[model samples]
Target: MSARLAPVDMTAFSPGRCARLIVKVGSALLVDPDGQVRRDWLKGLVADIAGRVRAGQQVAVVSSGAIALGARRLKLPKGGRASLEDAQAAAATGQIALSGVWAELLHGEGLTAAQILVTLDDLEDRRRYLNVSATLDRLLKLGVLPVINENDSVATEEIRFGDNDRLAARVASAAGADGVILLSDVDGLYDRNPTTHPDAVMIPVVEKLDARIESMADRGSASGMGSGGMVSKIEAARIATSAGAHLAIATGRIDHPLQALATTGHGTIFVASQGARARKAWLRGGLTAKGTIHIDAGAVEALRQGRSLLSAGATRVEGRFARGDLVVIAGPDGTQLARGLAEYDHVDAHRITGRRSEDLGTILGYAPRSALVHRSHMALL
Candidate 1:
């Protein structure tokens, strides 16, 4: 059985020290009863963000509401909930309308907000990752706000952020922002689920995240407006902080959630561990694998202890793979230990198993590369 846990403090997170911030607004805050866009709320939000921009703070907005807006606009058949496919379609339709609202509002403020839709793959590939980082860096440098969202229109079940909360956290880290603020319907995380436990206290701050805190989290939002809930939000915090950025979860009901989060104590703050390495964080948070490799126990220990996978440590390679395909690094026991792009195909890997690259020519009749997955291309799990 899972151990019982308490709540975290939210008021300790501050944004004053943050120069670049990522703010994710949930669907609950952006949609109304009519299932249409909430123009007034969006306008107010733009105004608030504009103030931050004027004050010399760079901001990235990760907004969610397109599906709800689209569902309402299209007036889909009466149903208790929107089908997953229906929701995806709605989001595609709503994105156009959503962007128009943002463009018009930001344009009126003499600021340009660029719409950037990305998928899991874009952030997974090192070259592509660097490319995106460069673009966001340039945008921030130029004083333009970037409005980022998942490429929901084209993403299939095989590849998705799964939700915007996770995506926002990733975006905050990808952009190298100073902090991430997740604005939701609730003010912060509770010690116990508030609905079931009347005496459940609201945690104010989390100095460190461990398995304990992760176990306390439940599933998706109870408000029914979005896919993310406390669990995903906490997962988001871990991602952001791992990327060397602070993360906060606060209520979107506040007039200026971002400013309040960055300045005063307004929500649950999850502090970063001491000097969490950036490269490892990118490996863990940025990349998604195309396949998996099963390595021996020795390989797992080496990778976990900050070493690379040697060709001799390989036990078996799984899936139809090509050179440079991102693959999972797992132990003999089948637990994922790391992720990296493969340097050879499955058949080639089988032939070269337990052999060093220098022996490739003599054993397999071909000269081989130095590493199965080069260190530069590898990321530990």
Candidate 2:
């Protein structure tokens, strides 16, 4: 028998990643109860974003403050949601200021900002989804930051996404972002309301969105903020992590909120899924691979890093499969790593092997898809 070793602590919290990130700023952080923008706090946040930019991380911001600003300007009710008509008027009047503020702040850090307003229907409809995705991809490629918000001025209830948290997750998925940070009033998910229960503990990381974990939501009005609560966050986590994006819920009340993500011991991270979502889960266990693509060591490393497989990285193609068919991703030595929906049919896939992404259109005489398999369409084994 060997000598016994010291037990290591496994419960401490540590922040991990973020390459391409989505940061959703709640109404409370940007606008005070009086409807004025918190310039200083926002300036600090922008500085943090600039830091991220310098570190080579791309970010998109989802902001929620139009209605709050609008409601205040109109002298709306004391304690509840405004009527649809009133809300529309408020959004129409307030959106200009909101957009201007974001533009001004981001520009201070030498970053260009683009405003994109959308309703739920834009994401649910396939054509609109592609359009939004393309626009976001283009903006990032051109080194511009995107600022997104709900188009409350015209969206009826049917197209309204209740909270920006969910919208951020949807947008993150579309942008192919790998991380989502929700800055909220509270630090993170807790067993109970920490204010009320002295013994309440914070859960630093959530590995699963099980019913047990979801039930910990405050369930109180607005969940705990102007529109979002623990409930909506849970839903958002399900969306982001399912797409293999790591999501963190941290407090925005402090100055330099984004910078505080790592040092602060007060946030919950929902780990990215490794074939956990239903679609990916199915791909991992239920599909029959109709073909295999032998990729070089470089491509294998990229796949391990959770990136989409580029055709240029493939050394050879084997078998036949159509676009959207399940195809195996293999190492040059023939070890299977993952399965994913093909973007090109077997004939086209074979023809494009070893070609640069930019040359795909020239070779195939069509608009080039950036990847042979998009990360969302893949499930790692």
- Per-residue error (Å), model 1, residue 216: 2.2
* Top TM-score hit: 2
lDDT of each prediction vs. the true structure?
0.75, 0.81
lDDT of 1 by residue, 1-381 (tens): 011223333334455457888889898888876886677877777887898788888998998878777777777643113566776787788889988888899888879989888888888765566557667877988988899888777777677887788898788766768778888887777777777876776666777888878877878586687878899999898888777677887777766666555555656787765434553454666556767777888777777776657779998777877766677888888988777767677778778878876788787677665567755456665
lDDT tens readout by residue for model 2, 21-93: 8999988788787778889999999999888877878888999888777777777764126578877888887
Query: Number of clashes in every candidate structure?
Result: 14, 0
lDDT of 1 at 1: 5
Regions of model 2 farther than 4 Å from truth: 1-16, 78-80, 221-225, 275-381
Give the TM-score (vs. native) of candidate 2: 0.74
Q: What TM-score against the true fold does each predicted structure earn?
A: 0.69, 0.74
